[model samples]
Target: MTVDQLPPAPAGSPPPARPGAGRTLIRGLGQLLITAGVVVLLFVVYEIWVTDLFGAQKQAAATEEVDEAWAAAAQTQAPQTDTVVVTDPAQLVTDPRERTPTYQTLTGQGFAKISIPAFGADYQFTIVEGTSDDDLYVGPGHYPESQMPGEQGNFAVAGHRVSKGSPFNDLGLLNSCDSVIIETQDDWFVYRVLPMPEEIPTWSSTAPTRPLCADVSVLPSPYEQTVGREITLPSDYAQILPVPGISDATVPADAQRLITLTTCHPQFSAAERMIVHGVLTKSYAKAPGFLPPEMGEA
Candidate 1:
């Protein structure tokens, strides 16, 4: 059995691992991580961009419905006898329960238009009737229990700060004295953001930064403790009362015609709430093709 037929070598341990095997495993892991990142990015895009498109469509449709309703009502509306000429806008609402005449609205119904001049002349959204997520998906939604626009109570509204049209995305940009205009079937109401508590102490030390708040009244007593712009938890229901921070049953007769806007704070996070309060400073009767001068303010 010379070298002509060499005995078969016995099977031994598996071949030593390849030098590039570790690198190959790392590359595969990197690919997996990249894919996961892309998926997460897509989800964010859908939430921020895709949802905005849908929200814009809903807002447009709601705006059209509001326009049509106003036009139709104008043609068929009979003259009202109870209409009282308001010589002073501050005297607009002596009673919190008294509201300007408006057509009845259902949940998710569009009843008004809100424009923040600080945002831009073109920035406007139809104000809907309820605060449900479904209602806010269209635009800023009114708290059903709160007073209507220009009423003597809080005209509370809520909107998404990051998505779904993001009507209130720049709420942080609005400081004291900025105007928030609301239009109804027959009237246009202008509300000026109130001064923050810090500013209120020095509000009179110098001339007001803007003329809107020059004659503005400060939040009284209990409300004085509340800031014009506040960060709070979602459970603060008193923020929407007739007189903010005051009990509904104990709302003073002189309760202000205030407007409160709420949105998620810190943008893209719902861990807290941001609120902005305003007071009605002026009101105008709606006329054909006439917009209030405040609408152009920034």
Candidate 2:
């Protein structure tokens, strides 16, 4: 048939392009891209919001379990009160090996409660026994190799910053001398954040900046490298050492009792880690209706 005489495409049908398939292919690709974008959006929402809900529920349940355990023990043991008169904030523990409140070693179980005054009165979480994914899915997870709370070594903890309730989301907000209180079945141990490296040279001279920070002078030289807040890579395990930054197990006979907190740095990313170091400053024996004065500090 002559070119102009060729039969026309059926009325209302799409005109041919190349082989009558180019338009269909473009439309299919566009639909696929739109669907992929929607999927990505939903995934982000789940990670940011839905995971938080799940974390909250898990934390609540863990807290309840710890409360019950503490209550059961109270029936058998007497409450420890303000018996020890604290004269020096630097020397709260008399014996280096004297550990208070023996801890259980079960993973994924809540054994301790942590409260940060800087994070507000409502800022508290039950610390799980292990740093495994399942354990932290509930709340802050304790490193199994670390020493127990109130011991003469580093008691390190790990938590999520952007998901699973984001317990340490505001860790960066903590300042020197801020209190990080840990509640055991028998007593409350308060650890104050160490001075930032910049504040160290003048820490003693500027005690008034955060009066409590002056107490950090008790820490040995090994801790000089440790700061109130630090950004480090995930591979840096020395941050949790017996004496932070000291890789060996040989802890000083008078090693200071310390607390270390770790979380993903910069939010929503795990490329680096955020480390916070604190030294034991004051400890209070728990009595019925008793509250540590540090808990109310700003």
Candidate 3:
């Protein structure tokens, strides 16, 4: 057959393989994927570390600003009863549980300091008045509608568990009797961590769970123990009550002074919320001299 008419190359003639082009495309794609993966990794690091650094700086500044405000207010006028300084161990300030706390405008305002030795002596953070996202990123944010620290009712607060300084990252470390102290402008309010019973009782007397975390590690805690303690669902608003987990319980007026510390459960996911409930066992006024011995209970 004439060259022009040469039988169309065998039906199975393999097309010339574009090995160079294929390898080039594959190399380019591989690089692109690697670049994307690196970006993702960097973002995660930022969330876990850089954001923490920035949030911590903000928290420190907030604390200083709060102190300055108190100083300014003290100079302008006699300190209010709320801030009355008391040094007598015999005159321990009765927790203001019987009285209704008054907070007019505290959004973004640092009104108090929260210290949990269980989390670390340096675990203290400024507590602002709102629980909104804007409020929590700086540090722990108090439930606006809840009672103020040392107030008779519930003083509930929310915080990040794994990001933005992870203020409540060590929440699971709290055990019954662990001290959750709140240093307000006027007083040092101390609350003891109370056991939160599980919805379902454990088969054994000891709850199956991990021991209270001893440190403020940012990683997810491994609950090595088999405690029957049930993790509360984040949606349970009752968890924040002055008398938590009690729906029909008495209102704040007739209830014990309570404090609730809340954070997203499971470390990273917001699928659930971790709640720590405590009762005010002792309240002390801001004493200029040596602190009460009992106040130093370790």
lDDT of each: 0.81, 0.83, 0.68
- Report how far off residue 140 is in candidate 1 (Å): 0.5
Evaluated with TM-score, which candidate comes out highest? 2
- The positional error of residue 88 in candidate 3, measured at the CA in angstroms, is 4.5
TM-score per candidate: 0.81, 0.85, 0.75
Query: Please, what are the lDDT tens digits per residue for candidate 1 over residues 124-145?
Result: 9999999998999999999998
Task: Write candidate 2's Cα lDDT for 80-195 as tens digits.
Answer: 55455454334433332454665465799898999998898888999999998999999999998898888888999999988888899999999888999999887788899888
Which stretches of model 3 miss by more than 4 angstroms? Answer: 1-19, 77-88, 95-104, 196-230, 246-252, 289-298
- Backbone clashes for every candidate come to 0, 0, 9
lDDT over C-alpha atoms for residue 151 of model 3: 71
Across residues 190-229, which tens digit of lDDT does each residue of candidate 3 receive? 7776544442143133424433322111111121111212
By TM-score, the better pick of 1 and 2 is 2
Worst 10 residues of 1 by lDDT: 88-97
